[model samples]
Target: MEKKQLFRNSVFILFFLCAAFTVSAQVRVSDFRYIDNIEGYWTMKTKLGLYAEKWKRVDDHTWKGRTMRLQNGDSSKVDDMRLFLEGDGIYFTIAAVRDSVGEPIRFKLRVLKAVGFVAENLQSPYPQKITYRWKDTKHMDAHFEGKDGRVSREIIIQYTRQ
Candidate 1:
């Protein structure tokens, strides 16, 4: 009888520990509220052309967006983008609108805060790291950084809410 009781106690303790670990590992979608600020249209002008991005919240756990190239009073779609929560992490994914044969690259969120977040894809050959920072209510900055061979390259863009 004592041996049976000891085995039962051990089983209960093991089950309790597994439940606790699972709860601690779970991530809630609501924890990333800072990303909500990205919703809306943002525009930036470069010497080459004017570009814009529009983001819309699909639900509490997802945002869908697209990049547009503006010229001659018209806009053309350049890329499709999305942010979503999966498993225990959030991911940012983007792909060129014209690249029908290529898969959208996925970047896992590495850091998140009230000001901004950083996402990275080590498998991507170029622009492996993407960072977004909020400068103010109406302004934001994005940086794309990667190594081209032995040379490091970075593109920085400042965007204004439109």
Candidate 2:
């Protein structure tokens, strides 16, 4: 009976540890920032064109984001997004709908490339990967890549803390 009790206790502890690890792996949305800083409205300019967006933290590992073309200045309808922080790196996903009525219409936004030995490079990174990069406390660059591989652009956004 004692052996059985010990085995059951071990199983309970293992389960508890697994739960803790799972929770820790998830990044909260509220902590979303470019690089590791620069939060709030951002503007990005790329070879394609200019775009702007408002990034607001919704939770610890989640953020509410909206991107608009510079010409129209109208917000794109984004459904949801998830943020993850890896070792020395941050990643996020923006649920974008490419077409009005297409199946499997959602695409992911991820950090594909990191340029610069220092985070303060003035020239924007190439081949848009993540939507935002923290160049410094006051400067950031927002990047957007399309799902179809037909459209990809980068925007250099400078910001001030509100």
TM-score for each candidate, following the candidate numbering: 0.75, 0.39
**lDDT score at residue 106, model 1, on the 0-100 scale:** 79
After superposing all C-alphas onto the true structure, candidate 1 shows an RMSD in angstroms of 9.6
Candidate 2 structure, TM-score to reference: 0.39
lDDT of 2 by residue, 124-157 (tens): 2233244455556556654443333544544345
Residue range with the least summed lDDT across 10 consecutive positions in model 2: 115-124
Q: What RMSD does each model have against the real structure?
A: 9.6, 12.8
Error of 2 at 59 (Å): 1.8
